[model samples]
Target: MAVGAAQYVRAMHTVAVLALDHVIPFDLSVPIETFGRTRLPDGRDAYRVVVCAPSPGEEVATGAFTLRAPYGLDALRTADTVVVPGTATPLAPLPAPVLEALREVAARGTRIASICTGAFPLAATGLLDGLRATTHWAAAALLAETYPAVEVDPDVLHVDNGQLLTSAGAAAGLDLCLHLVRRDYGSAVAADAARLSVMPLEREGGQAQFIVAPWPATPRGAELEPLLAWLEAHLDEEVTVERMARQAGTSTRTLIRHFKEQTGTTPLRWLHRARVRRGQHLLETTGYSVERIAGQVGFGSAGAFRERFKRTTGVSPQGYRRAFGGAGAA
Candidate 1:
């Protein structure tokens, strides 16, 4: 194994967070809180996290507040992993020094990532050529327009293509970091960290969930609020357009038309996905066994659950659990 990999396995991984000037305070805190708080099976610190910047040991305004980071470029040199968080200055050209440091680290096979719009600095190194990545959803179009060489997918929460990874904005960074912990150490360790942070054990739902949230059920008010609440409550039941229309006091045609206009999807597809999402949450957070989980999620059998789970995520419930449930594979 490489030195960094060895160190990581031994629970001595060093994560260097590069904080540029005009940092977004929320982005800076995600890694600091998530990675710094992880622990090994014996409760020993699992990582050595240092907040470094272009000008180490200097004070910089973080949009919300000023921060004093102790490590500098040197920390980047020795890091087992380096993370660059998003900044308010999304298109600001990265300094040559920052580009050089990231390039060197990539060359050495040091693990690296960027959160939110932080992909700008990492992309400056040109290592992301031909790789699929994402930034904040709102920036996806610009990122693709600016860096035509990069494949930008705006829907997923994050893409972990081995040494290089990128995440969507804000809270999605938590999902990506927890994913890394699960990948490196095991699910058990990641679950502990999630519990500590008070986040979901695994959020398999993609960023599409967010991008698709606002417009869905828009023009929402008393007439539709009760219906939506009903949909969420009865995902496990075999709900049809006819039933939904009657409940909403509309005919089937009117109900379908309004739902499609608001949600950009047919009622059945939406209903199916709601069940899948509910199943995803249950799979990640519970140990009810596959049969019971399938029944609870409205699947008639374990086979049916496995089929839908595979179709949606390209993985089985057991596989998803192994990846996100903090346990070895079933």
Candidate 2:
């Protein structure tokens, strides 16, 4: 028992957060709060979190306040994981010493993660080259433009490239942290961490869910307004191209062309998205069983619903309910 307890104590991971000048306050706080607060199933703290700066005694400037990090870059040398939070000036060049330190640790096979615009610094180190990454949607273009070799995906909440992970803007950092917890431990422990943060264990949908749908900026949108409303209203019904064409007073081919031009997506794809979105709402607000929710969302079977829900939301329907179900949820 004593030996087992010693092994358990030794299993705690160390997470070093690199605090750069002009770092976003919220980004800096996310890892500190998330990793710092995690507890293992045995009720022991799972991670030892250290916030470090380029220099040990120096104060880093945040837009709102100055923070004195207790550790320095050397802390990264012994850490099992390293995290870089977003900087206010993401486009600004990283300090050479900081960059070198990151490269050294990464070469040693330490797991590293970047939150939001932190991808910029990680990309600048040339580590993200030949890897798919994501930053805040607002900065995705810039990250791609600056590091042409890096594939920047802007429509996902987070991207996990094994040792190197990147997350999209703001609260997505929380998502990435929880994902790491799940990867390191398992779902039950991660779910506990989520509760402490008052967040769902996992959120439904991608960054695409947060993006506003682009409607055609023309009189054509007015013509489709009623059709769109009808589609939304009848989400649980079979919506065939032929039925849509009849309602639009046009041939099927013309309706297909009109939908593509107006929504930049096929009619069926749009409907599927709508159904998944409705499923999400039901999961969040109602205590419906997955079978009932599946049928209500137009899926023919619970098995099909589970697969689609996992594909679209990166989580199963039951998992989604556990995270977001509002009242009387087990």
Per-residue C-alpha lDDT of model 1 across residues 26-57, encoded as one tens digit per residue: 88889888889999787777778899988876
Model 2 stretches with alpha carbons more than 4 Å out: 1-9, 213-330
How high a TM-score does candidate 2 get? 0.66
Clashes by residue pair, model 1: 187-326
What's the lDDT for all of these models? 0.80, 0.85
lDDT of model number 2:
0.85
**Per-residue lDDT of candidate 2, residues 252-323 (tens digit):** 898778777666568887777678878878888888888999999889999988888777666778877776
TM per candidate:
0.63, 0.66
Give the Å error, residue 222, model 2: 27
- Write down the RMSD of all candidates, one decimal each: 10.1, 7.3
TM-score of 1: 0.63
Candidate 1 local lDDT, residue 124: 74
